[model samples]
Structure formats: structure tokens, C-alpha cells
Target: MSFCKSSRQQAILDAASELIATIDLEQRLLYLNPSARQLLVLPHDLDLEKERLTVKDLHAPAVYRKLDTEIFAGLLEGKGRWEGELEFRDSNDQPIPMQMTIILHTDEEGRPLWITGIGRDLRRRRRLETQRRLAKRAFDHAIEGLIVTDGRARIQHVNPAFVEITGYTAEEVVGKTPRLLRSDHHDQAFYDAMWQSIADKDRWQGEVWNRRKNGSVYLQWLTITCVRDVQGRIENYVSIFHDLSEMQAKEEEIQHLVHHDPLTGLGNRHLLSERLQHGIRQAKGQEEKLALLIVDLGHIQLINDSLGHTNCDRLIRMQSAKLKAKVQEADTLVRIGADEFALLVEDYSSLHDISQLANELKEVLQEEIDLTEHRVTLSPSIGVAFFPQDAETPDQLLINAQAALLEAKKAGRDTFRFFDQEMSQEARERLKLEQALRSAIKGGGLSLSFQPKVLLESGHVYGAEALLRWCHPELGPLSPGVFIPLAEESGLIVDIGSWVLRQTCKSLVSWREAGLSLPRIAVNISVQQLEQEEFPDWLEELLHEYDLDISLLELEITETGLMKNELKALMSLARLKERGFRIALDDFGTGYSSLSYLRKLPLSTLKIDRSFILDMGDDPVSLSIVKTIIQLAQNLSLDLVAEGVEDSCQAQQLFDMGCPHAQGYYFYKPLIEDDFIQLLAASSS
Candidate 1:
């Protein structure tokens, strides 16, 4: 082109997208098209010849230096044209990058007339290239898998993440349908619904079960969208997904832990309530009966105290396993407490069937279990409550079952009891008694009665046993049998026992001041009292407070209490004996009576249990038991006292058996403080 010669050519040059300009050999701008003016940011109204603008004014300084040395040198050396990237500066002094072609036009004389340059602004092209690079990088590095497919559902491209998730390389999956990844867990109907939704909404997102190249199935959260053309026709499909297999597995594990006992792997109390409620509903619908049995592993606290809690847990697991093996598949066994379990029987025929099952379950636990260090037997007590009979609701059934369990334990363990209205009444009465006893202990409604312990050889009062007595204002007089157990269960025995000790010391000092002296006063102690780690120190402080000798008070502990936790009881008794206090094993022959443990105890005397003493007159077995006990005491070099000695005949038999001491109604009833003093004075006379 002759560089904007005619109006038509000038108009075409002005409208062109490329920069078109002409400069003479002296580098002065001769003519400039509108595109060149705008690219250089020069005034469009200015006449280039009049303004004296040159190529140097538009080219950056560094770019002008390159054109002066290399570009112009090449164009003048018969090269005629130079094409490369060059920089142009705008009015703001900002560099504009351009791709340019410079042409050297010559006249008829073979001399350079002018140089015409055609350039294209490269900023927009550079931006498009940068965006393409970033998009490719994101597709390769994203955590979620990405897939691109053609409108025929054939895979066209796959990201590195897709290869990692599906174990399929791009070469293997390209041009293949998504059907290769189907796990076959979903039917055609499921896929049809998914496709229908996508067709309607242009997108679908949900969980899908798919197979990996390794033949393993997994869950994935997937989102698929249809890529459409301007005419709204299907062009491509883009899918993004993430593996949800690990998350789903974690959720299931959390659910299992929430509903199961961690130790035994059995159902827990929460699961029990749910299953019980469900079982009740099913029973009502089927016109069937279901029994809820509460099985209490009796004396577990004793086992825990004797063999440590770790072994106790092992024993509990063993028991749970046994109970599980004995129940049917329809039944549910739940660990409701540390040492308690509940059995839900759903397929029982009648009460007799439930009773038989309860007995079988109890007997299963009764079998001797071999703990690592000790082989021990368990005595399990079961309480049965029927659905729609004993209780109508799960909560009430559980409560009544527990109440029946208590009755079973009270009836001497290794047995089962059916729930009855009377048992609930007794449970309420026992709760009332527990509350009343707590108040009595704090309000001084309790007292101590003394029964003289006489010497069978001399008929002289040597000591008296102090008994705990409670007289409620409204209940008149409550038996020690009824309220004492309540006190022990409610943990009130510790305070009550301490109060008795202090009052007995006061009584001893008072009797001394009244010119009457009993050699020693024996006071009953509960196992809970001896279990106190500070019991010995507390007793010493109480004795010192009264200014009484420790020898003047005898501590009587039951054999059953002593045997509960032999090791701890032994240590407690040893500390007391070392402090110059006498330790007597009361109610002997009624508990374990194992000589292996008995001989190791630091005992001062053995009191024959009243049952043996009372029955010895009529039953030869009872007499032999008492005699054997007396001989055992003699052999152990321990003194003996016969309890429940009611007549001269029983006394003579005890004395003949070489029992030197006796205490019962025959000599004196449990007397008040004043009556005891009178008896003490008479004995002294």
C-alpha cells in the first residue's frame, strides 16, 4: 500500500485492527493511521506531518536503541524487512508490547523512501495465554477428581486426580463410557433417575457406589453438569467427585461405639432401652409375653477389693460371655451397670419357661471361672419382670426387675425372684427406713444397749457387748435386723458406728464413776467402718479424747465382714491389734470360715454364731460345729465366747465344751446404761 494515498486506501488503513505507520529515513513520522495513533495513545486530531512526531517518540528508549543498531542495520543492508517483537511507549510512559513487521519501501532509484510498520497489541493475547495455563494447572492438581466427556457419554479427558481415585490411567479410560466404573450396587432405575434429573436441571449431585480398577468398590460424592452450546445443545459433560469411603467407615464406627459397651462389646444401657421398647411393641402386636431379667453379680465389690479392678473387669467380661452364650438369638443382653446386666427374653412360652431360662443363666455364671491368679465362683441373683403383667413400660419393667433382684439378693444370692407387688411395697418401706435412719443417726434417736458377757467358770461379769438400738418416735422400735442393713446399704453405718464408739467410751467412764466397772466393753463394727483408711487413727483420737485406755474397749467384727476383703481387713486388724486394741471375730462359723484365712487373722476371741448355739441342743450337727469351733479357737490359742446362751442347759453344754465365756438372755437381756451399772455392781459384790 502507498501509505494512505487515496481516501479509500486511507479509510481501509484507519479502520484496520493493526497499527500502520510510515516514517522517513530521518525517522520523522510521515503518516500515521488511526490504529497506530490509538496504540501509541497520541491525539487522533493531530496531523502527524504538522506535529513533527517521529518513530523515536513512540518507541521506548531501549527499543529505539535496538532498532538503531540491529533492526535498521539489517533493513538497510538489502534485507528490506524486519519482523520481531518490539516495545512501544504510551503517553503515560508505560511500555506496550507489540508484535511488529517493518517494511523498507524504495523508489525507482533503488533508495529507501520510507519505512512502514504494521504491529498488533499483544496484552489481550498474553492475558488469554496466562488464563489457559492457570486453568490447566488447577485441573491437574485439584483434590477432587475431574472428568470431561463428549455428548455421547464417552470420556474425552481425565485429570491426574481422576486417575488416582479410580486407579485407571488416562490412556485406559479415554473414549470409554462411565459404565466401566459402576459397582453394580445400583440398578438401572437408579442411573435412569440420575440422568433424568440432570436432563431436567442441567446438573445432578449425589452419592454413588463405584468400582476401582483393582475390583474394589467405594462410595463417592459426585457432581455432574452438562456443558451446552449457545443453541442449548448437549456438548460435553463435566464430573467432579471425591471419595467418601473413609468418612462413611468412620461414621459407622462411631455409631457402633455409641451403642455398645467398650469392654464387653455387648449392648449398653442406651441400646437396652431402645431394644426393650421395640420388644415391648412387638410383644403387644403378637399377643406374646416378654420377660426382663436383671442379673446382679453379687459380691463383685468384694472381688474388686480382693483382686484389684483389672481382674474384676476380666471376670465381668467372662460372665458376660457366658450369659451371651446361654441366651437365644432373639434375646438381647445388655450391660446396664458396672456389675449388673439385663436380659430381654422375647421368645419365652410362659412364666415357667422364663424361670427356667433365668435359672440357666444364673447357673452359667455360677460355674467356676479361672482368673489368672485366682479361681473363683460367682453367685448371680436374677429378678424377673414380665411385660404387660409386672410392668407396662420399659422404665417400669426395669425398675420392678431391679426390685425383684434386691429381693433375690436378700433371700441369699444364687436364686431368682419373680416381681410381686409386695416386693415393691417392701422396697418403698426400705427406702423410708433408710431416710429415717439417716435422720436418727444425726438426731440422737439411736442408743446403745449392753448385754453382760459372763464367765462360765466363776459366774462373774467380765465384759459386756454393746449393741446398737434405734427407737423411732413414730415407728416405736425398729429391729436391728431391719434398719442395720438399710444403714449399711445407704453408707450411714460409718457415722453410726463412730457415734457408738464415742458413746460407749462415755458410758465406760460413767460406769467407772458410779463405782461399777466392767472389765471391757465390746462394740460391733461394720465392714464399712473397718474399710475406712483412717479408722485406726480416728479411734485412737477418740480414746485419747476420753482419757480411756485402748484395752478397755474391744472391737467386734463379723466373720462375713472380715472375709469380704481379707487382705484389707487383715491390715486394718493388724494396725488395731498393734495399738493394744483387742480384735474379736464375731458371728463365727456363719461365713467362709476358711482356716486358710482364719489362722492368719490377728484375733483375740471367736464368738460362736447364735444359729449354731441355738441349734446345738437339738441338732447333733450344730453341737459338733460349736465344738469344732471351740477346739479351733483353742488350737489357735484364742479365747471363745458362746452367743445365744439362753438357759443353764445351753450354758452347761457350752462350759463343758470348754467355752469359758457366754453372752445371751440367760444371763441378762441387753440392758440400759443404768441397768447395766446395777448388774455390774451386783456382780462386783
Candidate 2:
């Protein structure tokens, strides 16, 4: 064929030219299409060969260097053949960054004839590549686990953190939905809501349990966001989270510190107050009655001072454990003070039911506690105040129960008291006094005294009983007989009692240190204090802590006190005996069935009632009673002590009746702590 048929040649040329124009190449570039010329910039210097340029060049620097290489130069030697683009600086001398393709043509024998180059800017593609690299780096090192999914919820991407947290690498998770990480903790409603939120192009945040690499459970605080297209269709979902294990642990610790007693792990005042408030609201709503119990652990201080603080702590823990075991989930048990615990019976059916429950509690507390190689125990004195009947307010309810608790202490240890209308005024007064007592304790307003219990045969100062004497500013010198009963009633007896025990033990110890031939000092226990389940423990603790000789101490309990809680009192006395204590039966004849009861107790001494001793000389029957008491003690081989001897005759009469030990006014009235110390020194001298 000719070079081209006339018509076909023009058509082909026109078509070729149009194709170049469509790709945005200008007319000048298409016609000249020289590699060198295409890579050049618009002329800024004097024209070379009188040539003129129409447009600026667009080529990267690397492109220019490559095109100048020998390999590329040889490729274009014969005809003009070029491929790829080259660098060209603009008039400002800053090279334009661009990419282009070079074209080569051959006439015959594959020899190149003409070369053409085309270019396109590469800034957008480079920008996109840089961003991809950055995103990959971030995903690899992120602190939070990430999961990415398409609109169908099929997972597309999972970062390394996800594999670390979940034990699933991208290969295992890429095709799975987020359900793979779910712990199945949520129900249909939860998932429904989640899906609904995602469908609406919204976000979801909540707590969720997830699985770890080892198939263990983990808690996560997660956030999920749904990405949507311009048409409002779901595009993807992204979930990110950090493990909340440490945060959850901290939160639990905070909650425990707030709600539990540090000493016993029982609920404290803060927790008590919260539970009480909640209970009140619930009671009011349900038209129910709630019973409140104010429990004062009797004689805990004596044990604390005698045994040691460590032993005391152990005892307190034991008692709390016992109390917890007896209490139901609905019941709130609070160790509000050292020796005082409060129980709120929120689900009691009635007053009678509360009483029965209280009886059950008493029985449980009476159970012997085997501790530190000894069986120690004390009973619980429960004072109950019921809803609507005893109080209309929370504070009033607590007050009423406290008042009743005081009454129980006054009556005897280990007994429960219910609120009565007549106790309202007394309760208010008692409340005020208790507040004052609390202030006094904080302010250190308590004092101690000693009462000498003389050795009847020796007629000299021997051992003394340490007594608590409160030096009140507004109220005169408060006797153990006065404020102690009050203190015990108000559950303040624990601290007061603890202070007394410590003071007595310390004083007695100092006396021994001072070279005094002092006898053991006795501390009378209150009914409220004697009932503590930890009584024996505290006694052991105090003895060890103070490093006192337990045998040098005497603990006297009244028959009525013994009867109040026979099992608990017996256990405490048994524990004390095991610890080498001198336990005496005080006010022996006063109880109705003293003679019958005496034989069964773990007592070392029997002290006849003062009434019998006071009238022994006048009433022949009184003398007979004394003689009978002596014979009974002789039969049992127990030491005999006489109390309340007013004169020499009373002492002589008891002595004549063969009583072994006697203490009363005939020996000496009670002395202050300092005076008792001085007497012990003088007597030994």
C-alpha cells in the first residue's frame, strides 16, 4: 500500500490527535512531542538556537537523573526513543515534581525514529501513601485495642493490641464479627440497642466483658462509633477500648474501705448510715417494720488490756465472724465502735419475730470460741427498737434501741430490751449524756481509783479493785456505779471500760515495779461489757499486751450477772481460769438460787452477800446463813470472801464462821489510783 491511502491517512492522523487532546495534552506538546522539549520548563534565559517555549515543565528530579543515564541514552541513540519522565526546574529554580511516560517509534529494523514523553503529577498518590504508613504505625502501637468492620459486620481489620488483649491475631479475627470478642454478658435488649444505635449512625459506650487470649474473662470499658457514607448508609464500625482490670480493682478497694470496719471487716458507721437510710426508705414504701439491735460487747476492754492489742484484734475479728455467720443478707451488721455493734433487721416479720431472732443471736454468741489455745466467750446484750412503734426517725430509732440496751445492762448482761414509751425522756437525756461522754473520751476526761479488798486474816492492805471514776465538769465526780451503768447502757462502756482496764493494769504493774507487796487488783465488769463474744480474747490480749501477771488480777461477777448469761459467763470465766485468773462469785447470797447455782460455776472464791454479813450478829438466822455459806465453800474447797462488812464485829463474825477471805469498809474504803499506788508502797515498806 502507499504510505497511506489519501483519505485513511488524514482520518488516522485526526483520530490520533483527538485521542491526545482528550488526555489534557495541549496542541503544541502533541505536535512537537520531543522528550527533551517535553521535560523542559518555560524559557527564562536567553533563547537557545532562537527557540521559544510555550508552557512550563512537570517532572520529578529522579526522573531527570534516570533519563540522563547511559542505558537510557543508548536506548534513544538510533532513532529518538524515551520512556519515563525527568526533572525540570521552573523559572524560580525549584524543580516541579511530576511523572510522565516516554514513547519511542521505529521506522525499520526496530531502529528508533522519534520519541515522545507524557507526564502526570504524583502529589496526591504520594500523600495517600504517607498517610497509609502513618496509620499502620499508629495501629501497631496503640494502647487501646481496635476492631474495624464493614457495613455487614464482617471484621476487616484488627490491630496488634487486639491480638495481645484477646489472644486472637488478625488471621483468626479478620473474617469474624465483633461477636468473637463478646463474653455473652448482654441479652437481646442490649444487642438490640447496640445495633439500633449503630444503624442510626451513632456511638455506643458501656461496660462489657470480653475474652482474653487464654479464654479468660476480662472487663473492658469500650466505645464504638459507626461511620456512615454521604448517602447515610452504614460504611464501617470502629471499636476501641483499654482493659479496665486495674480500675475495677481500685474501685472495689475504695468501696471496701468506705463500707467496712478496719478492725473486724464489719460494716462501719458510714456503711451503717447508708444501709439505714436505704432500709428506712424501703420500709416506708412497703409499709414494713424494721428492727434495730444495739449490741454492746461486755468486758472486751479487760481482755484487751490483759492479753495484748494483737490478741484483742484477733478476738474482735472472731466475734465479727460469728456475728456475720448469724446475720442474713438482708440484715445489716455494723461495728460502729470498738465494742459496740449495731444490727438492722430490715426484713423482720414482726416485733415477735425480731425477739425470736434476737434470741437466736444470743444463742449463737453464747457458743464457746476456741482461741489461741483457750476457749473464751461472752454473751450478747441486745436492745431492740422497732419501726413505727419505737421511733419515727432514724436517729430516734437508734436512740430508743440504745436506751433499751442501757436498761438491759442495768438489768443484767446478755438480756435483750425493747423500747417502751416511758423510756423516751430517759433516752433523750441519755442521748445528750452519751454525746457528752463521747466528747469527754476524746478530750481525755476520765480518771481511775482503787478499792482495797483486804485479806481478812492479815488485816493489811493487800490487793485492790480498780474502779473507773469520771471527773465530769458539769456533773460531779461520776462513779463507776453511776456513769459506768450509763456508759454501758449507751455502749460507751467499751471505750470507758477499755480505758479503765488499761489504767488498772498499768497501775498494778507499776506497783510491782516499785517493790510493793501488792495483791491482785479486781475490776468489776458491767453487764453490757461482760456479754462480748470476744471477752475472753480481749482479756487474754490485755494481759499479754500490758505484760501483766494474770494471776495477780481478780474478776468478780455477781450471781445475777452469772444468771444473765450462764453459758457465756461460764465460758469467759473458764477462759480466764485457763489463763491463770482468780474468778470470784460476787454478791453470792443475793441471787434466788445461789446455793444451787454455785456448785456448777467455774469460780475460785465465793463472796457472801453483804446483807447477810451486815446482820450476822443480830439475826441468828443471818449467822446460820453465814455458817452455811462457809460450810458450802468448805465442801466445794472454794475460797470464801465476804463483802460489805461495815464494822469490826461483822468482820469478826465472818472470821469466826471460817470464811477464808474478806473485803469491805472494815478494810478500807476505795482509794484513788494514785493513793492505791502509794498505799501499796507503804504497806510493803
Residue-level lDDT of model 1, residues 1-685, one tens digit each, is: 4444588786788799998888889889888788877877888898865688877788777889899889987898889998999989988888888999999999898798889999999989889999999989999999899999999899999999999999999999998998899998999999999999999999999999999999999999999999999999999999999999878898999988988999899999999999989998988999888889999988888788778889999999999999899888878999999899999988588778887888898888889989977999988999988888888899889989988999999899999999999998887788788888888988989999999899999888899899989998888988899888788877798999999999998998887787776479999988888877799999999999988998899899987777666677788889999998998888787876556657787889889999998899899999999989999999989988988889999999898889999999999899988788888888778
Tell me the lDDT of model 1 at 642.
Answer: 89
**TM accuracy, model 1:** 0.56
lDDT tens digits by residue: candidate 2, 1-685: 5566867855564444211110112212333322233334343243433543333333245544555464246556753444443455655576645565555556779765554545554556778989999998998899889989998888999888888888887998887788877676778798898778766657988888888767889999888888889998879988898889878899999999999988887889899888878888888998988888988777676567556677778887888887888889878999987888999988676667778877887777767776666667775687888887778788888888888887787777788888897877886877677787888887878877677777677787656666666777788687657666567556787777777777777776777677777587777775556667687789779989878777877777778866655665676677768777888888887788886777667788887888988887889998888899899899998987788888987887777778757777778787876777777777877
Off by over 4 Å in 1: 1-144, 150-161, 183-193, 214-218, 226-236, 429-484, 490-560, 572-685
Q: Which residue pairs come into collision in candidate 1?
A: none
Looking at model 1, which ten-residue stretch has the lowest summed lDDT? 1-10
C-alpha RMSD (angstroms) for model 2? 14.5
